[model samples]
Structures are given as C-alpha cells and as structure tokens.
Target: MPKVPKWVADVLENVFSGFNRKVIVAEINHLHPFIKTIKFRGDLSGVNFKPGQAISIRVNETNFRNYTPSFWDSENGVFEVIFHLHGNGPGSSYIDGLELDDLVNIVLPRGLDLYKKEYEYHFFFGDETTIGLFKSLKQVIEENGQNYIGILELNEDTMHYELKTRYGLDIVSSSINKAQNAISFLQNLPDRVWELWQNGSFYLMGNGRSIQNFRKALKEKGVNSRNIRTQPYWVEGKIGL
Candidate 1:
C-alpha cells in the first residue's frame, strides 16, 4: 500500500490523501471495432514524474488497484492509461461508467526506477493493461530524444494509437480475451526477439505464468535474468470477491 496523500487523510483511514486528486475521466479511442484505447485522465498539471511509474487508484472503499501511465505528457499535468476491458473489476467498472468530467481518487505514482540510464535501446512488452506505462515511457524516451522499441499485445480491435513522430508502435495480434492468447504470442515471439536483445535491455509486464515462461526462455538462450526486468500486469486468480 502507498502512503496516504495529505489531502484525503481526513476522510480516509486506510489511505493517504483523503480528497480526489486525479478527478479521472475516460478517454476512449476506438482503434478498431473491438480494440479500444480507454485513456484514464488524472490531474497532472505541473507535476514532474519519472516515466514508467504507476498511479494506484481507489475506485471506492471496496476496490483499489494500480495503473501505469498512458501515452501523454506528465509534466504538463495530463496523464493517460489504456487498458482492455475484461469486465467486473473496479477499474473496469469505473472506466465503463466514466463521464467526461468525473473526479476520481488516486495516489502518487510509484514503481521501479524506470528512468534508468544503463539501458541502451529501450524495449517494453505487455498486454493492453500495460498501455499506460508504454505510453508514458514513449513520451519520455521521445522527449529525451532517444530511439526505443516497444511491442504492444492487445486484441485486434483495440490496436489504435497515434504516437508522436519519434515513438515507434508495433501491435501484436491476439484473441479478444488477451490473458491467455497473448501469452502464446510472446512465447513464440514471431521473430527476432532473441537477436534484438543482444545489445540492450527489456522491461516486461506480464502475467505470472507468462513471466515465468519468459524468464525460462531467456535463460535458456543465455540472457541474464538481470537483463530482463518484469512486472506482471495481471496475475491469474487475483481479481475476485
């Protein structure tokens, strides 16, 4: 759990900051008939943040989850996160019923120190759940004037994202239910994943099983475990009553 923010502490006993800081609204971008980029917006004005960090959201007392930043300018106080709807989760529920100007409560961004300088060619991979982190990193990498590689695994319907000129977007094909099929896609990696990592590092966000498989595969190919940084976007059996 994150330390409660200062504002909402008065009303919140288990959380920091008692007030609604983000005032979130959903930014729906329909890439195709099924692939939708639901960008969740929070108040980011004048806030300087490291790329690839995530904001923990408390949808209500009963629900709270973390979200990576979507492709948007963090410094300008505007942030976005994109996720494919799987139904029944609080995050999904709030996003489904979101209006243009509803205020949502959120915590400060937290995660691994993504702005790490050791990496050469930046690479990010995960399902639609990680779109926000991908988007946030894309902006930061491009803004810093560096070239990066990013592969997004999403349902064919939600394959829509128009990045700034400097960012490269590659969408992988998978079934509508991404949890299972996306894992298969990465397991095969179509082509060149092993060859591509010879000189740089990769940041991965995936399911527990997927990450386990990915680690095993990387080690078999002589890729150091330290060379791969991973965090699962959703683990099997985690979301529940």
Candidate 2:
C-alpha cells in the first residue's frame, strides 16, 4: 500500500464510510533507532477492539498496512501502536514521517482470535513485530491469573529495550546473528524452555520460517498440532501475510 497524502485522505474521509475515523496523533516516541510508538486519540465510541486485533491504515489511495494496538482506553478513545521502522519500504517511510497532531484515516480493527481463556497455561513466540501482541497478552494473562512465557528473536539493537528491560517479559531473547539462520537458533534453546513448550497452548507469530522451525520442535516433543495456534505476520521475500 502507498502512503496517502493528507489532502486526499481528508477528501475521501467524507465520501467513504470506511474512512470515517479522524485520529489525532497525541504522542510519538522513538523507542529505538528502528522502533517507534504512536498514540492516537479520537471518537472511538463505536469501535469494538480486542487484544490481538489490528487496524488498517490508509497510507495512500492504493496502499495500506495493518498494525495492532499495544494499549488502548475505550473510555478515553485513545490507543497506542508500536511500529518497527525497518526502513525498507513505503510503509516505513509513512510511519517515519508521521508527527504529533497529524490526522489520519484507519479501518476498523480486525484479526484472528488469539486468546482462549480456558487454557490455564499459554506460550507466545515471535519476533519484533510480535511485541504488540506480547504486551496485550501479558495484560490478559496477568488479569486472568494464567501462566505464560514468551520467546522472541529480535535484532540486537532492538531486543534489550523491547523484551528485557522495557516489557520485562519472562522471555528468552535470541539476538539475530548474521552467520546463522535465526530459525536454527531455536533448536539449542535451554532444556527448560523445551519442557515448558510441551505443557501449554502455543501462540506463534512473526517470521514464517522461524514459526515453522519452532512449531516443528514442539511437535517432535509430542505437542499435538491442535495445541498450537499461529498467524504468520510476514514471510521472507513476501510482502505480507
């Protein structure tokens, strides 16, 4: 999706019901050189959002991207989204260009069902793109008194601030090493991590190859396929998933 210029978004907002939202950029934080957070405020009264749901933003007349909310307050009509500005495409440029007080149009939230309250133990695995989902999961898991663990693969520059000190997730962060396949790193994870993998329902998101490798390891340890759930957010060489 291409980035939508403000003038065109404003004109189309009046004609398309899907573009009815008028969100003001309340705050923006540069969490890292490659990661940023955006806070949006508006009349979000009619919106029905869930922990894992994502909103599609019109970057341009023909381009758009889906992003999950890291946090939100329905009563206050505000939400925050953490973006991984990889600087590889138009979407990155669009997000990088956004400033405080900017207005934009976004579609209503939509995504796969990720949470199952019946499960007493939960496991989450993903990369940087999975941070928002992890944040949301942590809140729900704590609120419901469920046991959960997260394992993430992030580039060295973003891993510490994201999973370690910031969110304080009980996670195993493997920094990406240029000489090795990231998925291969999963096979050498601590024995205890493998032990826990067999005892809970797994939610795997992020890089397709990494998810496949992790899921394969779980299955080899006798975890039923039914015990695992996944949504591949992106694939190498593929635009989106």
Q: Which candidate ranks first by TM-score, i.e. highest?
A: 2
Best by lDDT: 2
lDDT of 2 by residue, 23-47 (tens): 9999999887788889999988867
Q: Which residue ranges in model 1 land beyond 4 Å of their true spot? A: 1-15, 18-28, 32-46, 72-75, 155-196
The runs of at least 3 residues in candidate 2 whose Cα sits more than 4 Å from the true structure, single-residue gaps closed, are: 1-20, 170-197
Clash statistics: count for each candidate = 20, 7
Model 2: what TM-score? 0.83
Q: Which residue pairs in candidate 2 collide?
A: 1-63, 1-64, 2-63, 3-59, 3-60, 4-59, 4-60
